[model samples]
Target: MTNPADVKVAVVGAGGKMGTRVSNNFAKSDYQASYVETSPAAAERVKDAGRELTDLETAVSGADVIVLAVPDIALGPVTETIAPMLQQGSIVITLDPAAAYAGLLKTIDGVAYLCAHPCHPSVFLERTSPEQWADTFGGQAAPQEVVAARQSGTDAQQALGDEVIRCMYGPVIDVHWVTVKQLAQLEPTLVETVGCMVGQFLKDVMDHAINEVGIPEPAVKAIFYGHVYIALTNALRGSNPFSDACLLAMDYGREAVIKDDWARIWDDEDLDRVLAKMLRLEKIER
Candidate 1:
């Protein structure tokens, strides 16, 4: 086992959103960590956090893991520059799977490529403190799961990669291993496309009800919030059998709101299409 003290981890673009979140945990960890950023604004943020920023080359030198915490669109050019400079057996960790799955990340024979995304704090989390309640995004107080993929390199490299992953995303409950393609699918397809879209759609319709339909806002929200929990528990957990009338209403709602061929989002072509749009690329090649 590689000791955490011996592991040299460098976070590139160390002042961005995801960068700052993970850097907070790494700062409290035993791993020797380096922060790197080129933008003056970001570099100042790093400095304000009392972390000395290292230049890209100095930070990547002999580093066991180089975390590219930059944006998805920047991954191709960023990896093109950094991947070849990595020492043998180093692992490159990306926070998102889009670029890695789309083949935008550069490849090197001896270096491992990994993508790890946090699942965030669950709605069902058993929170007992103000801190946990405030940490809806996890990594601070609330425990969360992670989904990760190792795209290359040996078992030892992966083990160390796992350690770094758990460290940076501390308070993590579990790390579910999946293929790079599977990780990509879980993200934009399952979570963003379906889950987030549904959430936003709910808010939109709620607004329509209160504003256009002339329903009382307090009454609508009172019924909606409570029913939301019951609906999820009944459908997802089978906590209680939905009344027969409720089932008919649900069936009608499904037919009215959901398309018959909505499952086509699972198709690989559709995944590639969405990934391209998300990454602002012409198309994902493969």
Candidate 2:
């Protein structure tokens, strides 16, 4: 039997928003986590969230499972850095499953990789508390009706993924799985759509709060609804079809809408200052 308790998780983006949430959830869950954030402040935050801290090499080298919580653009380099560091037989998991990343992950030898959630929960307005998110977006099982559809149309693994549609989001739902072959073709559009909507909404919030600068509220609601609903549906569609093309296409569309230049609205020199102000986050660079 697989011992769920034996899982030793290492989170690579412990200092960021999504990393913190993932660290917190894992802390509350039964698994053990070695939280990794390059920033000491982010590392400290992970410790405060009740997880341990370690550098990239040490974390992946000793971990049974490694979770990359970094931004989508950073995944390629980050994964390449850690691939050689990982212990034999260790499994790697990426929150975003875009084809570019999935293709990169497949290049790693002797490690298992899985593409799970495409979007982070903070995008949802309803997710005010970690508990609310834990309860609502936790996990789910796919419906039976989709089973036969998958069986005749695809392979067993593909059908199994289809069976997990129901549990895609709550404590009532369980974790879903898909192969690298499948994940590679999917995930891009889903991440792009979700990330773009959140970015745009955040942009709007920042614009309205230019005077307040850091304290944003209200508009965060629309951001969450539009972002999460769109992402979840795409995830379901991709993971169920056991194909990644549709999701990739969506990501392409979203990227075309808002590329990194969006960060330019705030001058480059003051970008850090702007982010600190908008998120009410204290700069922890020591």
Candidate 3:
């Protein structure tokens, strides 16, 4: 295993959202770390946080693990520019799997590519502190699991990558390993397309209750939030059986709000279609 103190880590987009979060963790870790940001505002954030910024070429050349924290749309060009400059056996980490799964990232023979995405703090977590409760996104005070994929690497290489992954997203529960394609499917398909869309739809419904139905905002929120927890626990964990009337209402909801063909989003063609749109490519070659 590579010693954490001996590892050299570079965060390429250290000023952005995920970049800042991971950078905060890395800055406090034992690894030799460099913050690299090109955006003016982002670079200032890095500077304000008391970290010296390194030039792109210098950081890439020296890093044992390079985190490409740039946006998905910028990944192709960014990797094309830096992949060749990476040291032999160095690991390049991406925060998302979209570009990697879509075959948009540039690759080199000796370097490894990894994608690790946070599973955000679980709703069921027993967070006792104010800080933990406030940290819904994880990494600061709340513990979160991560899902990761390695495109090319030996077990030893992967261990080193995992060490970095845990540190950058520390207070981590566990790192779940999956193939790049599987990670992609779990993300945009199951999580975003279905889960997040449903969450947003819930918000819309709440708004309709307050605005159109003229329910008191506080009363609506109080009832909705408690029921959200009950719904999740009852449906997902089988904590308690839902009431008979609730089941009837749920059946009505499924008929009214969901399409019978919604499961088709898990199909390979659908995955490819979503990935193409995500990566801004006309089609996925494979």
Candidate 4:
């Protein structure tokens, strides 16, 4: 019988944004954890958080799981330095799938590469407490789901990674397993390419109404906010059907705003191009 408490976990870049969040959760878990950060400022942050810092080599030497919470662009060099030091059968968890999907991470022979991403609190989450409502990014009071991918590992390794993933992102609803490529498609493709662009476009159009059309800000906000909520509910959950006039207007808006080839973002070549831009690489090998 394996005791999870015996598992040594190392969080690289422990004082970074994602690193700090997970390290805070790991503080409350049973696993033996190490915080490693090379930046003097970040190291000071770790100390301020009451966590002792360990050297990178020493941290990866005996770690059962190594969480690289560093940014996507830094994943290559960070993992390259730590890969040789990783213990056999150790799991290297990246916070995002971009580097992994682009084949930028240094490969270790017997080590597993797992990428686990937080979905954050959903728009439709039934948040009750003030704390839950305040935790828009989750890993706090609000419950959220995680999407994970194991690029290389056994079933047992994935199961262990799942446990670690859940612990790092506490108050998690579930962990949905997918391949690294699928996870990449879900993130930069589905979330950033489509969702975030639409969100920003809404702001752009709203500003256009206020600035260009000379609509009063308060009037525009009151009507637009209400309609946005209703639009989401009606379109996503079918809570109510759009009126015939509203449908016609929506069709006009769609034709006017969206490109005919907008769905091309889902294509693999486009995804690779997007990832290359994000990772600051000339091209993605895989």
Candidate 5:
């Protein structure tokens, strides 16, 4: 395993969103880090953050780990450009699994590829500080979990990837290792498709309640926010038995709002279909 403090790390899109976050963490760590950005505005952000920017070739060459923190659409070309220059046994990490799972990354025979996505602090995480409570996205003050996939690597290479994953997305609690396909399924399929969609739908319902039903905005927010917490706890954890009336209402709501075939989204074909749309591909190739 690579020593965390001695590893040479490079951030390819150091001026972007995920890039900035991971770069900030690395800046505060002991690892030797290089920040590379192509955009003028983003390059300014990186320099303004007190990070010295390096050229792509200079940053990637001989690096122990190279992080492609660019957008999913650019990952293919970015990897194609940089993968061949990497040192042997070096790990290339992406912040998301979509590009890797959809066969969008350029692979090198001796170079390892890994993808790690932050689980973003759970809603149920118990917090003791204002900072933790305010850091809803994790990687700042709150502790969070990470789901990662090592597409090509030995156990030691995987360990090195995990070590860097923890540093980049630090204050981390655990790292759950899974296959690239499994990671993709948990992301766009389970989380974005169902979980995030439901969260937004609830917001739309609340807006409708206030605007169309003429409910007072303050009163609607008060009840809806509290009920959202209760609903999640009861449904997810069975924290307490829900009342019979509540259960009956839930059943009615589910029947009215959800199709019986919604579970098909979990199927392998459906996963590929959604992933294709996400990656802007005609179809995923194996």
Candidate 6:
């Protein structure tokens, strides 16, 4: 068994908002924090947080786990650069596996490459309006309540819903795992079939409400207008930042919904129930 206190962790891209949050969280942990950031300002932030700011190559030295928090599209190339630098048995996991260059994540004989996404729903909740942020994460919406709800759910047929939820730093409302096969099939279809569809969804929703059929653009804007403000409520209410892997999953989910294509990419029953529950919660909050 590994001792949590003895574990050494490295965080790449430690300068951005998500990076800073992760770095800060690790700084306050019993584990040592080795920070790496391309931005000079991020390097200064690492020093200010009282952590060791090391070059990317040195940061992963002797570490048990390496967290790649870079943009989804850039992960593969970066991993290719660092694969030779890691020790055997090290685990390299990304916050979002959906968009990662999974093919580029070469594994040395003994290393474990796990692509994971964060389950925290509250992180997005933080990007909401200030007036309601307090109550959204306050007394009634405590972490314990979210945890309890998450415990009863399942992401894949292979694991308990609670076990999935428990792997996160904050509340993870739901998750959809992707296999290598699934990623290969879905990637080709995304650009033409999915991305444009999403843009159309946004535009169509706007066109309708401006006059009669759809919800008014003003009202739709108001909803997401609170997104930035409410995103913080998730963590404050006890949810952590949405993991990179989870964000990728959301990208896929949005694509799937827009294309009406739900097959091996995700589990339908689980997703529908989860979405319904989320909508219910939104209605209650509203």
Give the alpha-carbon lDDT of every model. Answer: 0.91, 0.53, 0.93, 0.93, 0.93, 0.53
Candidate 4 lDDT over 1-286, as tens digits, reads 3466999999999999999999999998888999999899999999999999999999999899999999899999998888779899999999999999998899887888999999998888999999999998999899999999999988888989999998899899999999999999999999998889888988999999999999999999999999999999999999999999999999999899889998898889999999999999898886
The alpha-carbon lDDT assigned to residue 57 of candidate 1 equals 90
Candidate 5, residue 185: how far the Cα is off, in Å = 0.9
Better structure of 2 and 4 per lDDT: 4
TM-score of candidate 1 relative to the true fold: 0.97
RMSD of each: 1.1, 13.1, 1.0, 1.4, 1.0, 13.7
Per-residue lDDT of 1-286 in model 6, one digit per residue for the tens?
A: 2444776778888876666756655665566557788878877876787766778778776776777777755665777888888876666656543333223454555565555443233434543444435434322222322212111112331232223222223333444545643432343234223444655766665566666665667776787546534544653454557778857987897786644554533453433333334233222110
Instruction: Please write out the lDDT profile of model 2 over residues 90-144, one tens digit for every residue.
Output: 6665665442332333336556555556322332334455555554333321111
| Positional deviation of residue 119's Cα in model 5 after best superposition, in angstroms | 0.2
Per-residue lDDT over 105-204 for candidate 1, one digit per residue giving the tens place of the 0 to 100 score = 8889989998999999888889999999999899999899999998887888878888888888879898898999999999999999999998898899
Q: What is the TM-score of each candidate against the true structure?
A: 0.97, 0.50, 0.98, 0.96, 0.98, 0.52
Clashes of 1: 0
Task: Please give me the total number of clashing residue pairs in predicted model 5.
Answer: 0
Question: With candidate 6 superimposed using the best TM-score fit, by how many Å does residue 182's alpha carbon deviate from the native?
Answer: 5.0
Clashing pairs in 1: none
lDDT of 4: 0.93
Model 1: lDDT to the true structure:
0.91
Deviation in Å, model 3, residue 40 alpha carbon: 1.2
